[model samples]
Target chain A: MAGENMVGTVAIIGAGIGGIYLAAELGVAGFKLRLHDIDDARLADVRAFGGIDVEGERGGFAAVELATSDLRAAVDGADAIIIVTGGNAQAAVARSLALLLRDGQIILLVQGNTGGSLIVRRALDAAGCHADVAVAEMDNYPYSCRRLAPARIRPIVAKRWLQIAAFPGNRIAAVHQRLSPLFPQAVAAPNALYTGFTNANAMLHVANCVANAARIESGDIYKFYAEGVTPAVARLYEAINAERVAVAAALGASVPSLEEWFDRVYGVREASLVETCQRLTYNSDGPYQATGTPSSLEHKFITEDVPTGLIPMVALGAAAGVPTPAIDALVAIVRNMTGRDFAAEGRTLARLGLSGTGVAEIIRVMNEGFA
Target chain B: MAGENMVGTVAIIGAGIGGIYLAAELGVAGFKLRLHDIDDARLADVRAFGGIDVEGERGGFAAVELATSDLRAAVDGADAIIIVTGGNAQAAVARSLALLLRDGQIILLVQGNTGGSLIVRRALDAAGCHADVAVAEMDNYPYSCRRLAPARIRPIVAKRWLQIAAFPGNRIAAVHQRLSPLFPQAVAAPNALYTGFTNANAMLHVANCVANAARIESGDIYKFYAEGVTPAVARLYEAINAERVAVAAALGASVPSLEEWFDRVYGVREASLVETCQRLTYNSDGPYQATGTPSSLEHKFITEDVPTGLIPMVALGAAAGVPTPAIDALVAIVRNMTGRDFAAEGRTLARLGLSGTGVAEIIRVMNEGFA
Candidate 1:
């Protein structure tokens, strides 16, 4: 493989909360690291965080010295590329990377929201790259971090078991072996479908936030992980989980229950889901604080999550004959409120170039794990 | 016609705004009147207002003797009963009236919400007194008055048209003949179904109030008839109108558009619907102020209107395969907020003793008129 010597070098795109923490973690673990973000302000903030130190205790750190404006230049000689850009920015960044990335480079999406890996793959193909790059996804970043300022990141929790999978199911083990030393929580998920369906943040956050729009709009600063999970809210959480499960089943992915996934991610034993969320938020060293941007559920819950995440699940649920009334009502309400038909938005099956396949065929392809 | 001797005497139940103004209007016109209410204090208030005097001009003078009671005494020995009890008090008053009402007496329900005529009819049947009583309904009382205190009613707008009908269509002309002299614009509706379906207040108020619950809770109050009729709010109004039309179609009833109904009811040649509502509220010489209750929409909109009025329309819409997404979502959200399954609590075809009938059968029964 060309650039085999660059195996330990890592490139992280988009220095957002997720990208910054991962770069900090991996850089401190002795990996040669390069951090890049489109926002100049965000890039400056990362530079203010003492630059990525790559020669430290976790594995023998390598300082993160390289930062770039050009996406292609950022991933030119890197062994692994970790993408943490916004969902809107994903395709463009992927296109740029595909144009310059060489063979055998690993492109790992920290959170493959709305089939970001597939989108990236399509963009790469469009850019005419023939390299056999390993494209994979990790469902979501395995840590909870918040940008306290333009520069400072305060991580709340480092997840212990993060389910990761390569594009094709057969190559997951190989990817895990390479990433295992860096992510102690790394586990080979059944396929990309498993990762896609197991996105609890999107599932839980969307419903809770949307339903409580009144409370949120009134400037009731909600500790989302703490006070947000009341009994009624927990029922909403379960409903969302049910939708995710239905989608996973329809896609032939072996997904764990929300509670089980919670345990795996938090490394907590015998903790109820609500209690776990509460404990995380109420913790003294936790990232949650009294002030932040208005967590308008309209955007995160209805606009992004419902259309990009929940609608797909709902479609799959309908295909599988799983009645998801709560999810359906939510989708309808959001549609009414926003005056938009989310079902026709981007990443839908029709938009994804896979409109004709039946549920069974879709499941087979998802299980086989191709972009 | 054994009760023809007593036919000229009008019994008004509930000495609230509607009851008192209706009694005053009929009484001043030389009809013997008896006013009844559960609240003794409210009865004293009506008595203090000089009963009813209908001598000079429109809003000139009125004085009439009234006997008030809990329920039993209200319906006893009366020729025609006009029910103006609180929405929540309807079932109880209906039950009591069934026990005391004599054969051939007329029971007219103002604000004939969600099968109000049927509710009273069923109660009479249950009481084993299925006599030759004419159960009739009016779209609403002809005046709007407010109980400013225990004994003071501030008159608002007296309606121009008072559409009256009997439950079985046959008695509509006879019923209209008896009631028309008191209302200059009195007209015979097709049947009780038409009267029930033309309740514009219920249709417009419920959806807007429930959808804007957050704003209401935040203490934002606006003249519901005026400022609340903005474009966004009007969309909800249109949705409700559509549902009402669907219900009317299901029952084979002729339903008028809101604009047409407003023009007919208000007797204004060029006044828009919103303008009529505004004038009804602000016009001092109008009867609406004198007979209308508090401007709060919660009781009429949420409690009575939703379950009694809207749900029936929803059920009919379901039977007719017409989509009422806006209504459905509003009902669901209100039910969630209030912790009630309004559908089960609401009036339905089965509740009205027409469960298994086709539209033709219902039409035939309505045409035959109630005895």
Candidate 2:
């Protein structure tokens, strides 16, 4: 049915790099588009340009059907909604969508950031919006992109593979059917649990960032991955990744080791994780090349990732009865460094509405509905 | 009294900076010295020079009665045995002394790195030595010195104050009596627990090393304290110090906060730990100015300090039921960085012969002996 009647009108929220890329691709592909961002300046640029200019990989002056800062008008009658506001804004976006969303609509988080769907679903329930909508998430953004100008985006490369799944995973088939056209590389994941655990960025960013805390603060310009991920740092990555894999296993989710993921995804056939990172840093034209290390400890690598990435993993590990000592230690250290208690302020399972639930119940809720 | 009849003969172990500095000072002070080192080359240099050439502050041609590679010959007939072989060599030195030591000879660890006295005493007991020797420890090396050549050293500066304590709290007076003549600034601590917890080096080294791990590995030459102790890194130091203070409190050992210690010891008054470190680094002629950042993670900042310093602190904290989450986290991170399971390989409470004991028992042992 999804193949027969490909959802025509699409709502793209958050005019960030990912959101703009999604809009440009879908708009050029003949799907009607409405783009929304809380930043009026960005929306004004989009409106003035009449649409976004796409370059590299995909090229077109993709016109939008609607560009507005209005939340309700953006998704007024769209068949599908793509949220790319990042993990920090996920809860607020979810709350706004809860009131405007109609029945038979689909919501997808561009990158779930470890339990994005569950968090959005919980926010929807809390706001008393019980619309018959399907919520889904991808492991990461489909494109590595940058905004050249206000309304100009360069999509450097589209990811070769991604995992997509809906909350209460039974609905993944329907969600995957619709998403596959836009994301040809996406394969249906068993559930959001699979997608969440496969978030390699969560495991990768924090430790390396912490390891290079002084370099970042010293106002020195250096390659984050190339210079930062030394042998010891790479070893830390392996250690943290092992803990992550154990937690995933305890939750009945299968995930690749960080080394395996790097090898499989990047085609970096190095002897160790350290070599893999070094190879990817110098040789690849991927996100690693485009990315800059955080300017301060307050940057997203710690501020956003600690709460959305590590804290959630720690909470999930605790609920699953799997020890995440390395991850837990990281959270404590970050807390000390920043004077912020991530466990208290972060995305705990309780905040995601999975409190008092054991491993079996968590897996059950993840596969089935919250009911 | 100690002043009435001072120890006339002293055995100096290891020919490192601390050993050479001790030997030079005591030899110039007119006490007979026998210096021992496993390295025959260093002994050859000392023999060739006819004695150690001392420079800076207290300069003299300090003669050694004997400088040999033989451990038994080093300690034979010496009234005081000074172990300056560093923490790594503590166990082997203790075992060797167990066989060679005689009655009424005092054994002192130059820098008791958080339970050094206890570990040495345990080794002696395990080796079945029942000599009436008082095993004592000082909080840190008395002089911040460097060796210019074999058998030649420059005493940078004597520590303004140092804490000396015996294994049992009650024997401190006797140890202090002999030690004070050599170390005029030395004061009596309640017990080795007080001296151990007051070890500011262990609290300061690892976290800052980890924060600048990539920099250290990159082989970039920089001042360790000035460039490395950025704001976030200083915050980590404070957090670790807090944990150390709590563990000390639980064991009835009082120690200064890192900030307080900086002010009291270095006379660098500042608003925060960050400012204090910065002031000391740029303004003072102390150890911070002279010490270079480690070339690799395998340096003593991680390798030597972790096992002998942090591991013991964590063990003591555990015995006292004090949760050292930050310190424990630092240990885990260091373990990850170095590929060493510090908790397993480094000192544990059980390893120090303090297993199956609670807070009250630990404090009791600190005041009393193993009996």
Candidate 1 on B213-259: residue-level lDDT in tens? 43443344545554444333445566567677777877788787777
Highest DockQ against the true fold, candidate: 2
On residues A1-371, what C-alpha lDDT tens digit does candidate 2 reach at each position? 14444677889999976788888877777788999998877788789888888886558888997999998999988888989988888988999889888888889988888899999999898898878899999887776666788788776566667899899799998888887777788889998888888786687889988888888888877688888889988888887889888998899999878876765566566887767776666664655666687888888778778888888888899898888888878777788877888778778988877899999899889999687
Q: Chain B TM-score of model 2, please?
A: 0.95
Q: What's the TM for model 2?
A: 0.94
Please give, as one word, the docking class of candidate 2.
Answer: medium
Candidate 2 clash pair list: none
Model 2 whole-model lDDT (C-alpha atoms): 0.83
What is the C-alpha local distance difference test score of candidate 1?
Answer: 0.66
Model 2 CA deviation exceeding 4 Å by range: A1-4, A24-32, B1-4, B27-30, B128-130, B146-153
Report backbone clashes per prediction: 40, 0
DockQ, model 2, C-alpha based = 0.77
Q: What interface-residue Cα RMSD does candidate 1 give after superposition?
A: 5.8
